[model samples]
Target: MKNLVALLLLSLLYLHGTTSLAEDINSDAETLPAFCTSYKCPRYQLIKKYEKFEHRIYNATNWVTTSLKLDFLGIGLAKSFKRLLDYINGKNSEGLVMKMTVPVRIKVPRSDILSTNATMSFFVPPAVDTLPTPLNPDIYVEQLPEISVYVRSFGGYALNSDYEKQAKILVEELEALELSYNSSYGTAAGYNDPLTFFNRHNEVWYMAL
Candidate 1:
């Protein structure tokens, strides 16, 4: 009978230890910031939420950007991405190896004119106070002002054509709701690496007129 009682106590202790470990792991995961998980962009509060879209108001922030004058959208994006990566890899005046933050942003032409010039930008991590000077003349840093944007989000891998299509759809939705917007230019915000398997988040943003 004493042996049986000791065995029960041992089993109870083992069970309790297992449960505590599992809870600790879960708590740690929950505490990790969104930026570390799923390549979430920098922290920003949603100023206004709508049925079809939301208004994201971002504070003034700095960006590292590269401009390419390529007629092919896919080719241009690929080239620009490589250039931006170089900057993060210590190709700068300060030789600072900057931490990459998401949504890699692209400024697309407003119309379907197939222009040769487009701009791609990467957000500077919040921990950065001073902008690093780019070694390449074409790659420069800019401080953008506090801005409000209307955003429509979607999933899946996005190409240049996809951005154009999504931009059109977002404009139509906004028009139906009688919301005024600046149709001159649209920006594409991508929040995932190209190799991410599923639930890739992308957004089409327009400055609210």
Candidate 2:
């Protein structure tokens, strides 16, 4: 009888262990992070700005160097404009924005982002770079374009995986709009705080074509 009891106890423990493991797996799958299909408004600060617009030019005739340059360019601009947000709106805002000298679009050709990076570098000024500034009480979000776009917002690092997910969601939304996109013409915008995760930082995916 003791042996049977022991076996029953062991069986119960085994079942409990399996059930817990299954629950954990289910919980983890359920907790899988979700992506937002709308825009986000984060607090921002404005430092200074030059009156009137200036046209910046960039040339990426070289492939390797241009790739790095484009990466830096994106990073710098995201920071600089975030600070500039303080000036445009108020001491507190949720984001920053600017009108592209030209309608900007991301075109990954032949699934070749590296080559496309070189070509895309031809759009912006070469010397122009993102300038970091001290945080202030302002947000400088750019004006929303008249062109219809399905914006997907995400937090944390704008990893390629997150981008892929957002891009897919945006495409699906656009399809519902009856608008055509090449699926390669994606434009990105995002915000991040150097200090905290709870702070408002978001990335937006758009179809620029």
Best lDDT goes to which candidate?
1
Worst 10 residues of 2 by lDDT: 1-10
Clashing pairs in 1: none
Query: Best candidate, TM-score-wise?
Result: 1
Candidate 1 residue 21 Cα shift, in angstroms, is 31
lDDT of each: 0.63, 0.30
Please report the TM-score between candidate 1 and the true structure.
0.77
Cα lDDT tens digits, model 1, 94-209, are 87775555667777566544544457788885556677789999799978888878998877766556766767778888899888887776787766654555766778888877
**Across residues 23-58, which tens digit of lDDT does each residue of candidate 2 receive?**
111111111112211212211222222131111122
Model 1 scores a C-alpha lDDT of 0.63
What does the lDDT read for residue 167 in candidate 1? 75
Which whole-number lDDT from 0 to 100 does residue 47 have in model 1? 83
